[model samples]
Target: MITAQTFKRGSRPRPFLMGILNVTPDSFSDGGKWDSPKTALAHALDLIEQGADIIDIGGESTRPGATPVSREEELSRLLPVLKELIPSIDVPVSVDTMKADVAEACVALGASIINDVSGLGDPDMAMTAADCGVPLVLMSSYGDPSTFRTQTIPGDGVLYAREKLAGLTEKALEAGVREEMIILDPGIGFGTSPGQATEMLAHSSDFSLGRYPVLIGPSRKRFLSHAFPGKDPDAATAEACEIAASSGADILRVHDVGRAAERF
Candidate 1:
């Protein structure tokens, strides 16, 4: 079980809220509206008021088929917002990036967590997190944004994700990252179909694999779109998030904080 001390070092034994702040022009939801530092900070504060435990800020759009942004462009978009919000927000700040440079910079700027969707496939990423001594949330994905959805895996999608995450966790630990400083996310909708995502959520315990806390992000995903074709995608996404929280996930990464908090 994850204790308070472990959490302080950054691990959660129970479900926690991780609010999303996408600082990109092409993010699937609320992209340009919060792209600027002022608006982003305001939105982050609003999420905090609505019961968010952590704020995950991301500059690049990692939605499938999305083009990669340059490091300079990503940093320009993220640092300003992070600089403003870090001082004002009461909860931990997580920078969502796969690049080692960006991760290092964010850690230096008082961010406590590194949410890497690449699972530290970039060799320097794990070393960077270890060097900075911050908690790292490693999400399991088959590939990068460019070709992730094209990759094929054997067995159930949730089990495949779990196996990949397990391997990454071992690699990260071996690379000098403390065990307590690591968290696992199943990467819902990253490379799986709508049915696969649902199956993963239904059998989330399988992803736990062992004692590590599982972090789930089901907010505003394409899977939710397919799950509720006629209803509002946003609403369906929030419902999916609620299901994840109720199904033994340790953290819920969401865009609609108010609705999510109400559901919780």
Candidate 2:
């Protein structure tokens, strides 16, 4: 349901919910819960029923210190689920990947969006997105999952995010992606500290890249847990969603799609 008109900047759109469907055994939040195709498909359907506007499917875990999966392994895990789920879903389907090959394959298999948490770090990633003619969620991140956790945090997190996203916006545009197909994410926990993440959330609107829509994914993140000790991560994630909605986020990527939809 996300289109070029739906992503206009300078004006906030009715916040749309992007449900997370991780078909991996090592994702930080719901590892091993929906690793199978049957379970993953069922969970995705449930999310759509609960009001998810988009379904983001990921085969690899981008958790801190996580081991990176091979391109073939990632393809193995995702293609099976996407092959079946895309044909059945009513809303748009996105593939969460940083690999150019994986992104290309998924788009060919009917994915509408490519959510790259690495901010187009891969040289071919931007080109793949352009060739597919799908929207790309380029997050402000220093490196891949294995190295992002150890990257240096800027003293001014909001400023750092804005600058990084600006540079990435140019990269995406130069690679031939249409301006409206680029969505910017601040990469809340990728390399940010607890305070840094909070700062970015507080200033989400400032991180927008010209006319590009902003997608905020603070769902069940470690920074949220660190902010409220002993509090339920789901509750914290919901609170973050509320903040993001008010701060000009056009799309919210989350695990609890129903709750986020209600909050938005």
Best by TM-score: 2
* C-alpha root-mean-square deviation, each candidate: 2.9, 1.9
Which tens-of-lDDT digit does each residue in 35-105 have in candidate 2? 77889889999999988888999998999888888999999999999888988878889999989999999
State each model's CA lDDT, in order: 0.81, 0.85
- Tens-digit lDDT string for candidate 1 (234-254): 688777876776677777888
Off by more than 4 A, model 1: 1-14, 148-154
TM-score of each: 0.91, 0.94
Model 2 RMSD vs true structure: 1.9
Looking at model 1, residue 184 earns an lDDT score of: 85
